[model samples]
Target: MNFERRNLSDDQLLDLYKRLLKPRLIEEKMLILIRQGKVSKWFSGIGQEAISCGITAVLGKDEYILPMHRNLGVFTGRDIPLYRLFSQWQGKAAGFTKGRDRSFHFGTQEYKIIGMISHLGPQMGVADGIALANKLKKNGKVTAVFTGEGATSEGDFHEALNIAAVWDLPVLFIIENNGYGLSTPTNEQYRCENLADKGVGYGMEAHILDGNNILEIYNELSEIVESMRTNPRPVLIEFKTFRMRGHEEASGTKYVPQELMDMWAEKDPVDNFRRYLLKQNILRQDKDDQWREEIRKEIDDNLLIANTEADIKATYEQEVGDVYAPYDFEEIKPGSETENIRFVDAISQGLRQSFERHENLVIMGQDIAEYGGAFKITDGFVDLFGKDRIKNTPICESAVVSAGMGLSINGYKSIVEMQFADFVSTGFNPIVNYLAKVHYRWGENADVVVRMPCGGGTQAGPFHSQTNEAWFTKTPGLKVVYPAFPYDAKGLLTASINDPNPVMFFEHKLLYRSIYQDVPTNYYTLPLGQAAVLREGKDVTIVAFGAAVHWALETLDKNPEISADLIDLRTLQPLDKDTVYKSIKKTNKVIILQEDSLFGGIASDIAAMITEDCFEYLDGPVRRVASLDTPIPFTKALEDQYLAKGRFEETLKELVAY
Candidate 1:
């Protein structure tokens, strides 16, 4: 062993040996349990324990670490209680995720450890957000995130690296080149010579290390992380190693040749490190045996406790209520003074007020800093809060949004603005899978407000003009707010930011400069899951949101005799069922309007809910007024023909007559 033990004390060297042995022993024990059907499947870090153990051995406890499934050493090295970790594997109620998920798919706040979601690359971006918070707070803390060679092919990998580099966030991206991603080889994953070389493209400093060498990894990373804490920059370090076992116990290593497996086995991290420790006289043979026996006893004791723990029961109501963190919504007393502002200005006012209230609030998106976003919604924001609070991120929607989740993890609220609602598809996975499920999966509050400038009628074509609120309305653990007038827009956005849950605040692009209303200058909040009745009548109830509410207002204005109660659905996810049902009972008829295409739109859900609950209080069947089922066209004439405005007036008359 050519590796020198430089700064580490003799005691620290023995501790490192113990760290390496713990995960390897735990993996061996779990594999037996997996085959016995006493525990679920496991991702083995049998050979690559050196990377996780060495990194955590040097990493600061206050700094966060987002570990991949294979990085079991991170949990054990952090001194996370072995009994709870075993319970997590056994799907017991006492686990971190409360048996909501299996394996390392959980985040524990107490340990400052965030485990990976199945999508390996998104966590890199989330680490960026935590680093951003550290930088903003000037805490001199850095975040470390892990990924594999296979996940390097994911767009999120490139996006996260670029964003971290551009922002100069203190994030250490450690890529484990473990030979294969599932069954695919490294040659099949990427054409690059080394994963570290790809980091150079982002102008980040990169390095390659002997992953099996625990002494070298610990010494090198200790220096790198210490420097990063003060300087605050992103670095990529690729640890070249091999996965000795299959990806999981179930997936056998059929694709890997016997020659390759035999070759890597010779350089196994645990055995080699133990040999080096004894050779250097840093650890005696008897002492090493004593430590190994102690580790085995601890594992057995924890396993016994976990085996006796109760399994999580499938209680429908409890599971349903666990989806969102409880939020109290109270109506603010209205101030008399008001100013007439365009819908866009109202949104800006709300954001500015939020910034004033929350000192740690951050707003980030593409071109949102100097350019004031795609629309001029944030025209002078840079001058007010400076660049640190108002960040202009690269066009990596997935990474930036995931970063917002990371920021929320560290007690900083972030607003991620998608250039257009249609562009959210690029970031759909992080929003729907990670951010939307974080609270339910592990009880983490994703305090992020995604500002999506949506809705058609501006002739921006399909990619730019989309009313995609329905995409998230059906998703659990998300608060969707789409307002029609300037007043509702201001209040609801403020409310959305303050809400503990993840919020999707949709702003209609067409209504940016078009509609003007007397919005309150004072910072006020309208309760989420509550409907506002703009106009009341006895004939019928017209339900609408966003730009569709304007169409409903126009239809009622055109035919004064058509007495109807117009309802604006301020929030979509927590639909104001009480208000909608009350209106339906009074009028005995309803027309749900939306700018989205007719098929699979939110209007359908509202109509169905009305029919199910208020079936008896119906003079006629529920009606829907929505756009034609086609991609929003670019031409003005075509766009006009496609919108619901053409059919709204006729539909209202028909429902009123019925």
Candidate 2:
């Protein structure tokens, strides 16, 4: 589509030039600061300033902006204080992240600018989520998400685009084609002729703009933003710009060709805009020089202020300590009464209780609202709590998790669902980058709970039935919980919702319909990092979680002589080492049981921990009972043998005999 070129007024042209120049100065100053040891590192938005500034000029100030690392120009144009930016670079307490985040990861909720996540394409999904929220709230605000051409190659980018286009959300995706992804050039990264053309695959409008030309960038984006305000459809704008500097301060441009560098330098966005302003007589030589001097002085002053700010240090002591909002534990009498309740009903009751207590709690996932989730864990929630609290999201896993992170960061308790646990692979980037690292990286709490139905049972094949909790337990900052019984599931899920950090709540699909112990209808929570001792014995400690927990219990019932203490590890991250030690001390033996594959499973970690912490207490060698290292088979007989459940019983009996 051809963009109409309207003659810009002299004043308007000068304003565009001024906007571009500010970012240019900031980039230049940041580079100097790195050399001078004032800042640790910096990402330069040198040749791409026009595209960054142009998008901000068109987008409403109240609208949300989820920018990538190299979009300093966009934040500057949005009036984010330079001092705060400098402070973040200096790792000072006054920084946007309170000295927790790196310079490029700055964010301010008050400015309607969500933080810039360092991960490549996950932020694109987050931007779509913000737009979804705006659409739901009828806030009439657009979301402008920015990313590099290399990011388009990521699965999250496609996921975000697909959902945004399908929903027709008011989201403007800006793809900055800066020629290269670090050392890899565009040709090697993607085969598409133009990045904007990829939007056609999603059935969305796409535009290509001369990113070096500030007027062209501004006019095209302005029209798109205006259209989105009314029609509220997703649009993709590919900015054909170039990165004049290396990817990060640490990266040297020796790999970049001198000829290509020279070519891009000649098309510098700041210089191009300045020349346009001078040609139009909108900015005289004297006024331009004076404005440059003033901006330079302002930056210098901000740098000085940032350097003087206090340093923010994160200590391991604080890391283990509780960081979430404190809640007074209500003194509700414990019930000895046992009433059989369906696992799904227990989940619904637990969620209803938590939502009733915590007004800020929100639930979102595919078919979670009307259909009440694929497993019906959220059945009748929409009818009970209304659509606002129980939101049905488009089929976008990345967007679902990213939006949960966004909502959690904004002081809301968010529970994101993946229809099946296997689909979590689609949202892995956000889970690893944003959810797992947000706490330690930014010193900000990400109180989000991600629920997925996992474990293999019944006739569901390899694709449908695979326990992937091990993949997440390996990630730091995320608390992985797999509750065996309905009561523990309800209690642990409630605790996860109230916790400060992100949690991966795994529910075994096989247990959803199974009748288990009675769950209280009243408010209840099981403390994280605490394990339940289901059965007390002296033969061995059978440590298990989720579906394996039930198997261990059954094995204990079958082999009464093989007295073993069953420790259900409710939360994996903060493994209840004390309980495990106690069990080991009592039984003088240890056996880790799990349904996941033996390779790198939670059992291996638990075995290592027992060896390290309770090795001397052990009477015999520590053993593990886990599934064989193979994909889940489709047939029931094959799957039963593959899961290694019988091995668990044999291992327990052997431990008692030994």
Candidate 3:
């Protein structure tokens, strides 16, 4: 696999030409199809195929590549069936995504290719995750992720580079500096003299190359990738190239000065490579013409077959069902062994148990290693499990979450912790858009649990204390779990880890050390999407979760004369609707409680569901008792006044009397 420019045989040189020419032919036909209204929009790599084909040329079969929209050569170079790829582009059921996504937005696990989302930069983090798995497994596999010059501006890009550098993961951060990000010129994108220069600041090895020269790109990547397989460190390479066409076919290159377009056109990768092969006495003109004709015929024949494939509507039910992985809701009974511990200790025990039981399970977060964690839940975990499984991360939520997604797809279980629940906003795109939608889009499982220490009561103000469960519950492919007690926390956290879908495990900071319960010492799991009816009564049904469940318990204790049914919803997404409905049937009245602000909280959605489904069983309106729609205050007085716990008793009294 060692590649030397002078040692390359005539056949090897011809193979490189064919690889470069295939994508060129495909792009030309695709642009014509777009004009004829037979195809959708296209991001043409008309002049920039060398970077894709060159890097892929030297890649090992087990190594992974995360390609951007413009890098169509990565797909064709991997020898993916042209017919199925055409089907994917045409939104057919035979496509990789089952037509859920279009163009290069889909990934096929079978190909070792992780596709890019529209956001571009997050895939950089995903590459780190895949490389992290390779490092952990002691496998020599490497990962290369592609991006445009413009995407380097993203915090995700910086974060990903820093993490990869710190961990010394075997990742190739390739930037195709096409001189423009859409319409913005490269000079305007950053002030740096070269994109490769940014890599030096991160203390990573950096290289710059003439991207149009196919042989140069191939030689450089071959040596770098080979070295990475043995020595395993991240390297950033900037391929100096230009986008010959508009960003896409529709956005005509009118913004470009004709002079610039003509300049790059003369340096076209495919054309120059073809001419170079001729001058080297390797490929005759007739052979080159024959190869181009054969490629066009291959494309035309496959496109015809793809056009005849089933439409997306033919697989409507399957597409809808794939929004979440198939899951069983069976509840497991706890073993005889038990221990009296706080909620925080229960979480630590659950994590320890998971690590002991599952060899692939790993946890990553900021200061979770020797520092334990902000909450000390992972204290002493490094000593028990070692630093490999218990990883300390940079203050980069986006990359950390993306790494979790990468690991889950690569046959590993990952747990990512947000320092505080509020900090998850920085990583929200990958959690909601990428991880949540990955299963639905491509039938790939994202078996990662994001541990969020959420909720108010510590007077930590707006940034530190916020209940954001509604943010993920509404996202289709995610599972949401908010446990109330130590027993449920351990059980549900274990259950969340075992689930094949992405689960958001929210542990209320207030309940961390405040609640003490006898939890099972052995590993056990409670059913997710099932409510726990802590107390049963006939007058009213009080639905709550997280710390709000404690508020309901306290309120019910104070009103001994009032008969109330307290339902603790352990999981929020698959929502135990049947349990809530059954409780409503008996009680004939309902009240939803939450620590989040009232307007856009989960309580509003639950209240609406009750009104819609339990209208006939209701004796009165379904009321919602939640915090006021305002930022959490720093002072204890205003904080208590703004939280739902302050008014829970009075609201319960009014609802029961009504």
Tell me the spans in candidate 2 whose CA falls farther than 4 Å from its real position: 1-15, 32-42, 90-103, 115-118, 183-185, 248-266, 305-314, 319-339, 352-362, 367-372, 379-395, 409-412
Off by over 4 Å in 1: none
TM-score of 3: 0.98
- Per-residue lDDT tens digits for candidate 3, residues 463-523, read 9999899898888999999999999999998889889899999999999999999998898
Winner of 1 and 2 under TM-score: 1
CA error at residue 505 for candidate 2, angstroms = 1.1
Worst 10-residue lDDT window, candidate 2:
322-331
lDDT at residue 607 of model 1 (Cα atoms):
89
Q: How close is candidate 1 to the true structure, as a TM-score?
A: 0.98
List of clashing residue pairs for candidate 1: none
RMSD (Cα, Å) for all candidates, in order, is 1.2, 3.6, 1.8
Q: What is the TM-score of each candidate against the true structure?
A: 0.98, 0.88, 0.98
Rank list by TM-score: 1, 3, 2
| Full-model lDDT, candidate 2 | 0.80
lDDT of 2 by residue, 1-658 (tens): 1222387777777777788888888888778868887667778888888787888888778887878778877778888788877777777777665556686685576677766676777777777667766776676778888888888888788888987887777889989999889879999999879999998999999999898888788887777788788888899989888888888878978888999999988887777667666676667999999999999999989888877776667777665553333344343443666567988777878898888888778888888887878877778888788887898777778877887776664457788888888888888889988878766655656778888788888779888888898898887777888888888888887878888778899888899898567767676788777888888877788888888888887777876777778888888877888889887888899889889999998888888888898878888888998998999999989999999687887777677667
